[model samples]
Target: MSLSPLPLGGAAPSATRTPSRSAALALVFGAFVLAGCATEPPPPPAPAIPQYTSPIPASALVGRYGLAAYHRPQDATRTETQARAQCSNPYVITDGPNGGVMMYLADDTKLTEVISKQVPGQPTYIGPAEDPAGGERDRQVISFNGTVLQLKWVDPEIAKRYGIMVYVRCP
Candidate 1:
C-alpha cells in the first residue's frame, strides 16, 4: 500500500525539515551576548622634568673703572695703571648677606691666587677694593653706581675698624 506525500511546508512530516524559530532566536542571542562580554584595550604613560640654572647679566661688570679705599685714609688713591690691572682680574660678584655686593676674586696664579680660585672668562674691575682682614675668611659688601665702587663692611664694628673705600675709574 502507497502512503500519500506529506505536505512540503507543514510541520507534520514535511518533505524537507527547516530550523525551528526557537533555535534561530537562541543563536542570535548568544552572538550578541559574546559581543557585549568582550574587553577594550588600555591607555599610555607621561613625560619627564627639566633642570634649573641661573642667568647672570652680561652688561653688569664690563668696562674700565677705578676703586678707591672706602675705610682707610692711607689706601685712598689708586693710579689708572693700577686700577686697570685690578679690573683685569676675573672674579664673581654675588649678593652679600647684608644688602650689598660680594666680589670674589678668582684664584689666578697672580695677585688673587692668595685669595680664591680664578674663574675663567670673568671681567676684572678697573680697581676693586680688598677686605682688610685679608684671607679667604674675609667678606666685604660693595655698591656700584656706574661711576664708583663703594666698599663697606657688613659688621658695623668691622666697618668702623677697617672703614669704607671708594675707587674712581680713570676715563
Candidate 2:
C-alpha cells in the first residue's frame, strides 16, 4: 500500500471525499423535503364540546318538565350551518347521587345520576365518568329558562356521536 500526506494535513484524502458545504446543505434540505412529503396522517380533530352559557341550577332540575325546544348546530362555528330543532316530550329528575339529581325518561326504568358541573357556572355537565366495567360515554344536557326555554346540549357533537343524551326526555 502507498502512503501519502493529505494536502491539508497528515491524513490521506478519503476514497469518498467529504461532501462540500453546499452538497451537505443540499442533503440536509433534501432530507427536510422528504420529511415534509412523508405520508404520516394528520392527527384526528379534537372532539367538539358545547359550552352552556348559563347552567340551570339543581333546584330547577327536581321536577317534571317538558322540553319546550332544543337544537344542535350543524357545526360549532360561530355561524355556518342551520340548526336542527325539535320539541321533546316530558322527562323528570327527582333524585341524585349525594344531594345531586337523577334523571330518567318518562318510561325508562334505569336512572342516571346528574353530575354537577366541574366548571362553575357551566350548565348540567356529565362525563368523563369512570366505570370499572368501562361503560359507554354519555352526552350532557344544559337546561335554562329563556324566551324559547332550552334543554340545550352541553356538547352537541359528542351527544350526537354517542347517540346518547344525558337528559331524561320522552324519546
Best TM-score goes to which candidate? 2
Model 1 quality (TM-score):
0.26
TM per candidate: 0.26, 0.34
> Residue 96 lDDT in model 1?
41
Query: lDDT tens digits, residues 22-135, model 2?
Result: 888999999999998997879998756433232445565566544332234433321111111222344555766655467542234777664434445433444332321112
Error of 1 at 58 (Å): 6.1
Expressed as tens digits, the lDDT of each residue in 71-132 for candidate 1 is 44555454323444565442334434332344433332333211211123432222122332
Q: Where in model 2 is the C-alpha error above 4 Å?
A: 1-56, 68-89, 105-109, 120-143, 146-158, 161-171
Clashes of each: 22, 3
lDDT of 1 at 27: 92
Q: How much RMSD separates candidate 1 from the native structure?
A: 18.8
TM-score of 2: 0.34
Stretches of candidate 1 off by over 4 Å are 1-58, 70-143
